[model samples]
Target: MTARLANKRSFPHPPHAPPADSPALSIFSPIIQVFSRELQRQPDFDLLLAELCLDHVWTEPSKRDSKGEVANKMFLSHNVLSQDFANFFIGSLGQLRSIRVVHTVSNITTSGTMFTLSCRDAAPIRDGDLTVVLGLDNSISFYSGHVKCAVAVIAR
Candidate 1:
């Protein structure tokens, strides 16, 4: 029975290639294939791809250039810091076009190093988040008395 079963069934051969005129064989297919191959060549492609995918989605009017074609824009904001807790801000322009850094001030006085950050735009921080890291060289200190500080955001 085992010998008869082995001879009874045969698997079909795999297709060598997709048909030339198949709708799936459009120019985008080859471009996607090449893009995927190129992405595979990069060591950190997966991480980069994930970050790109996670960026924000926004709708804004398109400005026409000399070419005069409609374009879409995307905006995103994020923050990052070193293990030592040095502050920094990462903001994304529409379509990842540019990045703006928010200036951070570290004041070292008799009390301690006080860190302050100011945003240029007067608009409320819609998608703002902060991250803090404490390190040996840059540790947070508590003062005996309450300290008051005021922050103002001036728009351009």
Candidate 2:
């Protein structure tokens, strides 16, 4: 009852890097550099969270919940200016349970740019709330639901 092995040569590696002058390569280099520099300057979680609270784009019915209430659900969008900030925050914090890109359609068209971050395991206490931080020039905004609670902030 011995099992036979499949051929190993069928999975050869792709060709070497593209020539230096390739337009795609040239365009990609600067993008990569900017990404690397941004990563290097990633901010701490508290700072990021604070920024989110200030810049959040509230959906229609911009209402506030009573303090200490926990939001079981909420949604945030990349178009809110907070998405990029959250990405950098979570990426730098290295504590995200999962990050998913969701597609949403507006009244007249269908498109997508929103990122849904579920931090259940990573930030269990704040799991159900939508929190974000936006970084625009030198300004910062922070926004979160009443349910959002972070151990990092509690300790302070």
- Model 2 bad stretches (over 4 Å): 1-16, 43-156
lDDT string, candidate 2, 1-156, tens digits: 223323434435324666666786997999989887777787542423432233442222325323323333333323232222222123332222123333335222223433333333222123324453322232223334222222332211
Report every candidate's CA lDDT: 0.33, 0.36
Backbone clash pairs in model 1 (N, Cα, C under 3 Å; residues 3+ apart or in different chains), count: 1
Give the worst 10-residue stretch by lDDT in candidate 1: 140-149
Q: How far is candidate 1 from the true structure (C-alpha RMSD, Å)?
A: 17.9
Position 41, candidate 1: lDDT: 92
- Give TM per candidate: 0.21, 0.19
In model 1, where do residues sit more than 4 Å from their true spots? 1-21, 47-122, 125-156
Clashes of each: 1, 13
Tell me the lDDT of model 2 at 135.
29
